[model samples]
Structure formats: structure tokens, C-alpha cells
Target chain A: MTTEKMIIEIKKWLMEAAGYIRVSLTNELTVSQKSGRTDLVTNIDEETQSFFIKKINQYYPNDRILAEEKGYDTIDSLTGRVWIIDPIDGTMNFVMEQENFCIMIAVFEEGIGQLGFIYDVMKDELYWGGKNRGVFLNEQKLAQPNDVSLSKGLLGMNAYMYGKNIHSAGEIGHASMGIRVSGCAGVELIAMLKGNHIGYISNLSPWDYAAGLVLLDEFGFKYSNIEGKPLTFTKREYFLAATPTAYAEILENFI
Target chain B: MTTEKMIIEIKKWLMEAAGYIRVSLTNELTVSQKSGRTDLVTNIDEETQSFFIKKINQYYPNDRILAEEKGYDTIDSLTGRVWIIDPIDGTMNFVMEQENFCIMIAVFEEGIGQLGFIYDVMKDELYWGGKNRGVFLNEQKLAQPNDVSLSKGLLGMNAYMYGKNIHSAGEIGHASMGIRVSGCAGVELIAMLKGNHIGYISNLSPWDYAAGLVLLDEFGFKYSNIEGKPLTFTKREYFLAATPTAYAEILENFI
Candidate 1:
């Protein structure tokens, strides 16, 4: 199927999935811990992933899946027709604030990102696009953000990285206008896309960053492993995404 | 005049002032440095403060004014119907992202806080209330936030304070679920009021925190200098506000 057609279908699924998530928020959420108390997973996360999986299997049976709650253990490679999913990017936020969490999905064919969608369910803002197709927030086509430097723009950060001063992030933060933490990768990436923030850095898993990698590319933003190496997508890696200039500066001076 | 009558008049001025500020966003702003590079003031900030001063003088000439851009120097005491204003609470955010900034106004009668308003102009959210009265966001009456503990709730921190690890704030942050920084006192305070964050700590001037002090009081949140002392409102000081349980925990264990 064509990328355009796939996006339309994916968006419909996203909307329906978001509606389900919203309704669930009004009810009690069955939450469980994954790695620790800080690393949380909710029933909505598992259910949302199952919904997407069922849809994908029905529509595109050949596609492989890498998702947060399930299907991750079954997939080992991103060679062809891979759908990377984070049913709820910020589960803790969903459980705590119910405002900053998101549903993210990215489609990769032959290890190349063909489509990406990040649905901010509560705000009803969907950021989706692909390489050469131009990115958008809902229906509004997003323009390329200004090439703000580290000294002039806000930077989004992971709380742990900032607290621990990992990779000299503390020094890098001081050089920027300020640093902000929203506890959600999708929200931080959205901030970067809209020019509200110049960059974002965190230790991110494949599901945490797949959609952002695709969306950021279309807007001239740069991203990579913390040392400017390629992301392998097989493990959690220190990640950095920033405006072109800021990205380069961070790598050269701090990382 | 009665507090209800005063609130009605003040809200009208606030709406008009917010409208003016919104309109100014599309035009070129005259920006200048205040304390340093990080400390900024724009034409909108000055004009907004001036607008409030003009309306207050016209309506209640006997009232004294303390404001960010001007009038603050003239006030020595919070006696006799004094209005404290922060024309733009997050000037840097306003100048950079054009969001997360607020127009804060708090009224004190004989050193007692009477009414407070925090207008998040971009979002059009007005958090307003007074002592012994119910607090509200827009027209919805805000309820007291859940008495969450430090370990289960998010904490808001000022970038500088968090980065410097001042007052064992870094330790306190580790004890919490996570830390978020929005670069605006009004935004952080609203988070606590809505139970999005358990607490917020930072160094702030009177204008930065006065309205929040009043509004938070109505929602049963506790506030004090970081050291558990009262706010003097006469100088810049370290400040902390949190849910009642979180407040006691921080004060007893960390502060």
C-alpha cells in the first residue's frame, strides 16, 4: 500500500485508540510496575498495544512489530516492514497527570522510516508525517524551526540525565536559555518541532524515539546516539535531538 | 468596596489586558535586559503593568501598587489595599516561546492577602481566588489537590536551584517521582493546584510568588521559604510550595 493511504488508516486507528485511552482515564487504571516503581506500565498501555497489533495484523499481515508492552520480545530485527510502537510514551504521566502522555507509532520499511505518528491524546494534537512528505501538527503544516543556538533556546531534558549531570548535560543546560522536563519523549519532541524548545536529550529506547526520529528529520532537526553514532534500535541508548546548530554544538563541546 | 465587587472589576481589566498582550505577540517587541542576559523585559510587560496601574488608579486611587516593571520601589509595606503585580511572570518564556508566561496580580489589605489572579494569556486559563473563598481556573472551582507524598508525585523545580542542588533539592527531587520545569512560577503553581505536581521550589521575588501564595492558600497547599520560614515579600528569597503532606515531609526531612 502507498504511504499516503497507510497514514490515513493509521490516523483513524490512532483516533479510535486515543478515544479509548481518554475513556479509560475516567475509570480506574490497572497499573503495574515493570522495572521498578518509577518504570510503570498501565493496562491502557497493554490494551492500546494489543489494539494496534490487531489492526496491523488485519491490515498488513507481513509487518513486524516492536512495541513497549508486547511484541517487543518477539522482534529482533528492523529489516523490513517494522512498526515501532509506544502505546503510551509516558505511562507515569498518564497515571499521574493524564495530560503529557502520548501514543507514538512509526513505520519502517527496510530499516528506513516511511511514516511516523505521535498522538498527544489529551490535547488532541497529532504530529505525523514522513521523509519527503513534510510534517504536520494536525492539519497545520509545520515550518522549519529557526536554527537557535544553545545559548538562545530552551532544551528539554530527561530528569535523570540532568540530575546526574550525565554527558555534561548540566553544563550544556547552563549554556542554554533554560532546560525543561515534561517526562514524555513525545511532548519534548513536539516542543522541538514547534520551536518551543531547541533540543531534547535522554536515554531512550527504540519505542521512545522511533516516531520522533522520523518527524525531526523532516524539519531539519538532527538526532543520534549521544556520541553522534547511529542508533541501533536494539537497546536503550543515550539520545540527543536538537536543531542543526545546537546539535552540533552539543556534540562538539559537551558530549 | 467588597471583595466580590473588586474581583468583578479586576477580572474585566484582566481580560482586556490579556487581549492587549495577545495582540502584541504578532508585532515586534521592544526587548531589554534587566539583571543580566537571563533577566529580560519586553514592551508588553511594561505596557501591561502600566495598563493595570492606570486602571487601578482610575478606579481605586487610595490603593498602593507594587509591580515588576515599576511601582515596586514606592511600596514599603503591604498595608492598606496594596496591589502586587508581575506583569509577565516568565519573561524569558514569553520572549522565547511566547507561552508559559502569565500576568499575576495579588491584593493585600493591611498585610492580609485578599484576592489573587494568574492569567496564562496564551492558554487563556485564569487561576483566581482569595482567602476563605474557593479558587478557580476560568469558571471551574478548583478542589483541594490530593494529599500526595513526595515519593508518588511530581515535583517542580527552578532550573538554577535544581542544577545547583541547593537546599538538598536534588535529594528531594530524587525522593519524588520526577521533576518538571516549566520556567514559569504561575505554571508550576497551577500544576500543584490541579494535583499535577506535588510541590514546587525556587528562588523568587515577591511578584513572582505573591499571587501564587494567595491562590495556593485557598487550595490547601502550604508555602514558605525553603528553610521553612515565612515569606517576607520584601526581598527575593528561596520559596517552596507543596501539598500538605509533601510540605511537611520536605520540611522535616530535606529542607
Candidate 2:
């Protein structure tokens, strides 16, 4: 019943799920398209989701599930205990490189984030925390990244953002130390948490970033939609997750 | 000495230098700006070059060196035995993430690429070979990547390229499966070689791409400047390295 017990249980479950991904990585993967030719879905994505769904139904049946491949469109309420899961965040990266994709899950109770988990499968590094617990990478508690100015920090951006001149994403490109694109939302968000990148400018779906948003809030990061509005965990929007000073600099000069 | 004999000894030296880098990575690094605030030079960059210089001179004093930080910008000849070294290819990535950066070296004789070595330090994966022996990742000899079309491929691009539009880089974004940027030329080029990315488009100086070009050439990749000209290796130019079908498709549809 205790949050401490829940945290311990969640960590063990995450590591177990990650173990499945690692073992199956070398197996022949079946990949197909979603949305369009570029958007992809692999067998691993479906398998991982089924694994979580089966486990959750058996262990925590009452918890509402909003999973990427299934049950996402059916969610009309954020009430009760809701688990938002992105079984595989970077499916294309997974199908191709089999290196950068991740497994993400966020537990929310009555619309408040109770816990968040991001497992970088290839690296086996678990990033988890929310609210009172503070963010953590593996076991080490992370320190708050300083509010660095845009010019003093590198930016992790969506590659498409660079060409969308209307948003001044290209102008920000010239102002930062540099730009990097990892093609994975969970990994990019973790980079911002570690201070490897001061901010990430992106447009992502809910499953791609909900788990990361919880960790960002715990680390005191300024993350919001492009209009500087708070994320609602539903609709897709242009997102900016950043340190304070960096966020101000990007908004003032670039956006 | 035979080229075969030289390669055998040089691989040893490269691994030893990489060992030093691995050990010294955690030390306090002092960074200074070069060209502008964004371009950086760290003490490790200088130390690595010195380590290479001392070892090279001790082993082959008669050979010429054109290194990124030290002997670079002084080369009058590409003739004779010349070592083109980028002590650390992704300096900013090295300073920020302490990963994704690499040690790249290319050995040329009489304007011909004789041997090449790119050490992905954190992974301890060495991509090495030349005109004669063929490219190998670690001990595995790499086979040529299939000629996938542009629409089916992912392009690793310079984050800045997406905005330029001059090279139709943005158009290519729509044509490829997606665009990713690693902010490191050496690693990006390796990605292209492994088929994780079908191509890489960027404007890079010689040391930024030479060693990888050797590997690309051995792998039968088609690479050239934006105007479809050969790279002079003395100046920066927009470059494209891709599989056969992907190269042709990008050239026709986007370029």
C-alpha cells in the first residue's frame, strides 16, 4: 500500500520487461508501416505491449491502461489509476539499428503522475521518479541542471524542426553550442535531464513523452507546449523541455 | 616495410591510445573556444594528439603528420606517407556526454588511402581497414549494405542542413524514412556504413571525414560533394555518402 513499496515493485517489473527486450533483440524482427511509410511498428512493439498488458491485468487489474499499440484510443478518462505506456518509443530506430529505442511507462492516479519509468533497453539504464521521490538514473539521484543560457548550451531538436523556418527553429540552431537528434523521444528527454543537452524542441505524441514529462517535472525542468502552455497528456503538440534560462532564451530570441 | 606489417603494428598503437583515453576520461577537462564560442578545444584533444605524435615519431619519424589541432592547416603536400588524424572527432559530444565521440585516423601514401581506423571508444568497437584488406567492424568483415531506395532509408544529416534547403535537404526529409542527427561526423559515417542510415549529408573539413571515407569507399558507397564533384579534401563541401539505390534516388528526387 505504501509508495515506497510501489516504487520497489515498479523497478523490479521494469528490469524484467527490459530483460525480455534484450533477449529478443537478436531474433528476426517483423516490421510494418503505420500512418505512412516512415512511421513503423515492429513485432517487438506488439509483443512488449501484450507482455505488459498481461502482467498488469494479472497483478493490478483495476489499473486503467493507455498503451500505444492498443487501448490508447479507448481512453476517455484520466480518472482512477492510469498507466500510460509506450511499449517501444523509437520503433524505426529499433527495427533498423536495434540500439536506441526504449520502453516507457508512467503511472498516474486521479490525473496526478505517481511514478514514471523509462528503460533505455540497449543500455539497460533505468530512469525513474516523480513528485516527492526526485528523479534518478539507475540508482544515483540526479542533481538539478543549472539554468544555462541558450548560447551556453547545446540543443537536442527534432530534425524536422530545423527546416520549419516559421518556428525559428533554424535561428535557434545558429545560437546554441550545437544541435543533436537521436530519433528517440525517451532518450532525448533523458539527455535533457542529465544536462547533456539544455533543451529539446520537439513535436511528439502522448506515448512518446508522457513518461519523460513526469521525470522533467521532478527535476524542475520547464516543459510545455510551444505557446508556453502546460502539456495535457493527450493531444500532440510542439513541445519544449528545457532548463529555465535556456527556455527563456529560446522563447525570447528564437520563437 | 610492407603495408600489411604497418597495419598490424598501427592497430596495436591505436588500441593503446584508446586505452589512455578511456582511463583519462574522468579527469577534470579544461575546455577553450576555437573559431567561435561554439567550437571547442579541450586539454584531452591536445593530449591525445601529443600521444599519437610521440608514438608515430618514435615508430616512423620519416612520415609526415597532418593532425586536426596541431599540424593541421600546414600541409603543403598530400604526397609521401601522410597520417591524417582527428584526435577526437566529436569534441563537443566528448565534453558534454563523454560518449558518441571517436578517435579517427587515416594513413595515406602518395595521395592513396592506404589504411584507416575509427575507434568508437565507449563501445570499444573498432571500424578499420583500407583499399586492400577491406573494411571490418571489430573482427567481422562487413558486407555491402543492400541498395535500399531513398524513401525506404533514413538519412543522417547535419542538423543545420535541414534548414538550408539550398541542397534540397528538407525535401529529402520527406523522401526518406526519417532524418536523424548524432552531432558527430565519425559516428554518423559509421552509421551509414552499417546501413542504420542510408546516407549522411554535411559540409565537413578533411579530418572530419577522411578516415570514414576510406571505410565508405571500401564498402562501395557512392560519395561526393553537392555539385556532384569529387571532394578536394582541402576545403569544406556538402557531402553525400549512400547506398547505390539511395544515392541515385536522393540525387534525382531531392538534390
- TM-score for every candidate vs. truth? 0.98, 0.95
Error of 1 at A94 (Å): 1.0
TM-score for chain A of every candidate model? 0.98, 0.94
Query: Model 2's CAPRI class?
Result: medium
lDDT string, candidate 2, B6-66, tens digits: 8888788778878887787778889998887878989888988988888889989999888
TM-score of 1: 0.98
Relative to the unseen true structure, what is the C-alpha lDDT of residue B247 in candidate 2, on a scale of 0 to 100?
82
Q: What is the Å distance of residue A91 in model 1 from its true position? A: 1.3
User: lDDT (CA) for every model shown?
Assistant: 0.90, 0.83
- Fnat per model, in the order given? 0.69, 0.67
The worst-scoring run of ten residues by lDDT in candidate 2 chain B lies at B70-79
Which sections of candidate 1 miss by over 4 Å? B71-74
